[model samples]
Target chain A: MNIVEKILARASGKSKVSPDDVVFANVDKVMMHDVSGPGVIKVFDKLQKQGISVDKLWDSTKVWVAEDHFVPSAEKVSAENIVKLSNFTKRYGIEKHFKYGMGQYGICHTISHEEAMVMPGDVYVGGDSHTNTTGALGAFACGLGHTDVAYVLLNGKIWFKVPETFYFKLNGKLPDHVMAKDFILKIIGDIGTDGGAYRTMQFGGSGIDEMSVQSRLTMCNMTTEAGAKNGIVEPDQKVFDYLTRRGATNLNLIKGDSDAEYEKIFEYEGSELEPVVAKPFSPENISVVREAPSVELDKCYIGSCTGAKYEDLEAAAKILKGRKVKIRTEILPAAISIYQRAMENGLLKIFLDAGVTVGPPTCGACCGAHMGVLAKDEICISTTNRNFPGRMGHIESQTYLSSPLVAAASAVTGKITDPRDLK
Target chain B: MDSFKNVTSIVTPLDKVNVDTDQIVPKQFLKLIQKSGFGKFLFFDWRYDENENKKPDFVLNDSKYDGSKILVTGDNFGCGSSREHAVWALLDYGFSVIIAPSFADIFFSNCFKNGILPISLDEKTVEKLQQETRPIEVDLEKQTIKTLSEEISFEIDPHKKKILLEGLDDIAQTLQYEDEITEFEKNSKIPSVL
Candidate 1:
């Protein structure tokens, strides 16, 4: 059996399994956020109308609620919803609720990992699609609908159709300007976005050993762009080292058998990869920025759940140490905790000395609610996910998605240019 | 609901992949949950210029796709963040059927709840559909889509098919299961606080 099969076997208490089989697996963890929590609670209310109490069904330790987007900026309706959800959390005695103004909290996807709610081999589900980001830590994580999340909230069990696995074997070393985001964009461009629907993507090969934990997280975070359910990189020394640094012990390390069967396999050499960027509106519409003339940015932002790791910060700081941002730029560390760690290590000072305004560690500008909104006719180069026009607040504004290094260099130049070219 | 033994509609073609929720309806529009009047904001960024003037380069501005009730798009039609407003905006804009090579799981499921039919076809079939400039005939009752050169039949879950055939939303469908759900809930164990 494959890794996914093994995880599902343990989850379902079954000895063996295969792809395409439907199984009811016990959920290890269930997460929700402000946007989806209210809808789920409403469904729970309907279930409660029939006298169904969920107190006995769920594991209190495994449930988490995060108020990330629109935290301080929450609209009246969503704010009321957050209040109702907080009431539910209080009634249920859930201990791991992060509210607005809480230090070390940002987007649910990024903050959950920082808070150590995820563990290797854990079967996790969140009410947001990008919950797959947790897969980078070797967990079986995916997204579900509000109804399904509500059902899990009520019963602590959810159904799944096991999917086949696709192995991506990486080789060679990535260039200075090329990073994990470019690799993912290139893969999506080659596969045309839907190539891995309902499949598990497993990253391996010598190149996996070369990538830092932060880069691997960025790689797995965008598997959703390929329409994949989840993405996993086999645990290695780097992973263990990073987890140990984060104070994670007692991790369950699981790997695929040497001869594990996979539905398909893809191979790419990192040395051949260039700095790629996803054009507006589609991750599949990718081009190497150095080659594409239409690719220009008016603003540059570097920081998000996908690009906010310590290593990511260090890389940006190294590039911007003696440089001034020609374009207005904002660099948000993933969490206030991460920012504190960077400050302790002087990474924040390097960023600040280089003229980068470090915003609060909230999911500002990523979801278009606030922070780094663009002006009309302006464009931004962002490391966050989704580059749809107006995604960063201005409807007429265009967003170009790229890696942190590219964004930093673009900030220094006030236009979309290659990081290596700045040197 | 209006009744029809047979219904057919023409579709517009926009051959771009990964049409995310933000593109369908900007996050700013999410502030209002009234679930109506979002048609004008569908594809808000791509359809409009800096001054809020319509960009003639957008497919929606093309006269040929005017009043099109169906949308034919590229593969992975809905990706990125899961915002149900994407489905709501599309439905409010008068698009009932969306044909693509594939769709994101969350967006695909959301479309069914909003009484929109999201059809997934093979790449070859999608290309063939894209080549046809004229509006194609789509018959929900027959589960068949007809073009100038070919007729394609697709399969749907029995319950989902019933809902689409009757134009019923999720709330309406759940009311049918209310009796069984209530019985199960009544006999369930009470939850305990940790």
Candidate 2:
């Protein structure tokens, strides 16, 4: 069995499992944010009406919460949701509630790693689709809906059909100008939006070994765009060292057997990949940065769980250090910890010197919830996932998804510019 | 939860592909606490203009689909966020069934949990279903969709079929196996990462 299969089999108390086997695997960790937290609360209310116990979780220690999506409370409704979440957490005694303005709060996916909320060989689930981001640590992480998450909260287990694995092997290190965001975009373009639907996308080979832990996170984060069940990398020393730094201990790394099977194997030469962008309305529509359509981009957003990691910010700062942005730009770090790192490392000063606005760590415009959303007919170059209609505000507004380097370079010139092409 | 059975209704055709969750129920309306009353917000951007007036060009606004309980659309429906609000909005909007060539994983599961039956058919068959102007009958027990021209069969997991047919509460059903779950917890190598 492969890693995902082994994890599911172990959690389900089965000796062996294969693709298409339905198992109610025990959940090691579960998460819900401001958006899904309130949604789950609603589910709990409905379940209580049916006489099922909603008084406590199966294990409060296994459950964590985040105040992303609509934090800094954009308005009354969102503020009320936050209060409701606080009351819910207080009543339930969930100690790991990461509240906004209370230190350590950030996007749920970011907090998953920055705080080491998920560990290797664990089955982690969150209410947000980007929960797959934590799979970089070798956990079997996947997203669930409010009803499903609510069920997990009450039962500590949920059913999943073991997904067939699609292995992505990258040869050699990526070019300096290219990043994991670019490679994942190219993969998504090749496989269309529904390419990996109901399956797992696993990364490996020399290029993955050369990549940083955060870069691996970026790759797994966007697997949702391709409709994947989860994205993962085998946990190695890099994962162990990274997690250990974040205070993780007793790490039990999980890997597939020597003869483990993959439904398909797709290989890529890392040196050949160029910075790419996914055009508006769909994440599968891709164009290399140099050949991208020339549009008068109105904003350049460098934020989201998909982007805005510490390394992502360093990549952006590398381009913005001595330049000024020609267009409106914002660089919101994904987590407060990343924000502090950016400050300590002078990335924030470099961004401010480049005439960019750095906002607090909130999901904000990434989910089209608040802070800096686009206006009607506006075009944006964003280092965020999902460019669907009205995703970042007005339905008419257009978004071009790119790597942090491309977005930063574009901010300097007000057009989609390759990092190497920047003057 | 209502046990889903059969529905005979005019099919609402959304001709676009990748009908994402954000488009289903725009982000602004997600803050609302309740699951019901979201029907009005379903496809908000497409159905309404900036001033909140109904857009005449969008399909949902057409009087022909006013009472549609079934929606037929392009491939990769509900492809973005894992927000169940999208399914809630669809269910609240009275859509008991959705037919497409494919669906994103999370949104597909969200549909069944909320008593909404999502059907996946071939693209050509879905395109045919989309163009049907008359009401079509969807019988869940038989797993067949009856149109004027032919009867189309669909595949659904028997466990999921049982959930929708019996309106089984997922949590309640799991509680019946409490002993097994407790046994697993006692014997499993459960890690305390936190």
Candidate 3:
């Protein structure tokens, strides 16, 4: 049994269990954003129709609500939804409501980690599928639908069929242009999108040892692409050191037992992996464009919960130090705090010097609602999740998903070109 | 909401894999909190053209899929994002069941709460069913899905099974315990009454 199995077993009050075995487990935390919160509130209203009070449901202390996407730009309906959520929070006195433009906030996933909403050995659920982001901290966190979130809000527990474990072992060092996103995209392409459905991915091996904590976070962020509930890297000194630096303490170190069983194991030599990209339509529809092509980019976006880390910014800055963006490029830091840190560290200067427009740290162009909305036939190279057509603005707009380095290089070249080619 | 027990409908096949939540219901439409009226937005990006016009090329836009109540799709359907809008949009679009070889975890659970039955069958059966364009009779009462050529029986969790059979959402189902809950509340308030 692995630590996830052990924690799940203890939480479910079971001796032991394997993948595909359905178990009712206690939820440690539930988080929702404004977009999903409103729907959950609607369900709450329906639940209360039969005379059930919202207070009698889930523990308020364990649930959190944050307004990130479309923040400050709350349209009529969304504004009303926010008001309704505010009322619910005030009525319940939940302490974790992150109002727009307040305290160490940006995207929900980044804010959750910044505020330490995730802890090791906890089963956390969020309304967005990217909730798998918290698995970087060694917790079993995954996304759920609004109704399921509503159910957890009412019951503080949910049922899950324990998924099989898939071990992704990486050896060798990643190339300069290659990072975690490329690795994950390559893995998804190899395994096919559905390969890891209803499964947990455990990343390990020497290549993982070479990855920074930020890099590990990027890798864990895309576990959803593999259709995985969560992705875990065994807690090592690097993890402990990173968490400690982030002011995290009293952390429980979790790992698989010596004899733990895995449904599938894949070994990869990271040194051999080059920059990869997932073209439109599907993440599994991947191709390795070793030599950056000359496909002109209409826009270049270099930020998201995945690619807005300080390291990601620094890497992009290094590439764009003296170059101006050829395309209309937007650089959004993950959070206000991260933005402030970049400014303090002079990374923002590098971006400004390189002619990149810096925007406030909302979801920005990631969800394609505001900021860098694309026009028909326009193509963008973004460091966000998913490259499905029309994902980032225009219905006919094409999005190419890649790493920050790839995005920065493409911004400078005005086309989808490899960073190594620019160098 | 109408009870869906024993209702039979012709199945429309959506053969694409990894039908994500975003595709099911675009984020733009998520601004509305209400569950209804999202049927039109279902597969918004896929069903529409660049001019926001309906793309005649899309399967859902085809005349054959009109009034499609049962959607049979490819494996690992609903692969991306956990937006409940996917289920809401499907239900709003008049789909009562989504039969596929496999479903994304979050989407699978969402279906149960929204009165949409997401039935996972063997790959062979899914392929076999995908070939049939004619309406397949899905008898919820008999717990069997039958086409002119083949019939297959499947099982759902007893709890979800009952919920679907009764057309009860999670809230409605939980409300059944109102009496016991109120009594327990009263007893807890006055322990001496025990």
* TM-scores, all models, native as reference: 0.85, 0.98, 0.93
Provide DockQ values for all models, in the order shown.
Answer: 0.28, 0.60, 0.39
Best by TM-score: 2
Task: Give every collision pair in model 3.
Answer: A292-A418
Arrange candidates by TM-score, descending.
2, 3, 1
Candidate of highest lDDT: 2
**What TM-score does model 1 achieve against the real structure?**
0.85
lDDT of 1 by residue, A1-423 (tens): 777777776776666779988766778899987777776776666556655565553677789988766666555776776788789888888888887676556778777677777877778899888888888787888888676677677667666788899988899768877888889888888986677788898888888778877788888888887889888877767767767767789877777667788999999998899997777766777878787555446778886777776667877887888878877788888776788888999888888888778887656788887777777778888888777656787766777788888778778877667788896
Single out the weakest 10-residue window by summed lDDT for candidate 2 chain A: A47-56
lDDT tens digits, residue span B1-194, model 2: 77887999999999988889998999998898698899999999888888999999999888989889999999999999998999989999999999999999999999988899999999999999989999999999999999988899999988889889988767766777789777877887633322
- C-alpha positional error of residue A161 in candidate 1 after TM-score superposition, expressed in Å: 2.1
Give the per-residue lDDT digits (tens) of candidate 3, residues B36-101: 888999898888875779988888889877887888888888878778887888898999988998
- Mind sharing the TM-score for model 2? 0.98
Instruction: Write the residue-wise lDDT of candidate 3 on A1-423 in tens digits.
Output: 875676576556667778878876778899998888888888887767756676665689998988777776646776777788788888887888988666666788887676677777778989988898878777788898898898888877777888788999999879888989899989998988778778898788899988887788888888888888787777677777776777878877777678988988999988789888778767787878564345777888988888888788888898889888888888988877789889999989899988889987777678776777778889888888887656777767888888899888889888777888895
In candidate 1, list every pair of residues with a backbone clash. Answer: A55-B191, A55-B192, A56-B191, A56-B192
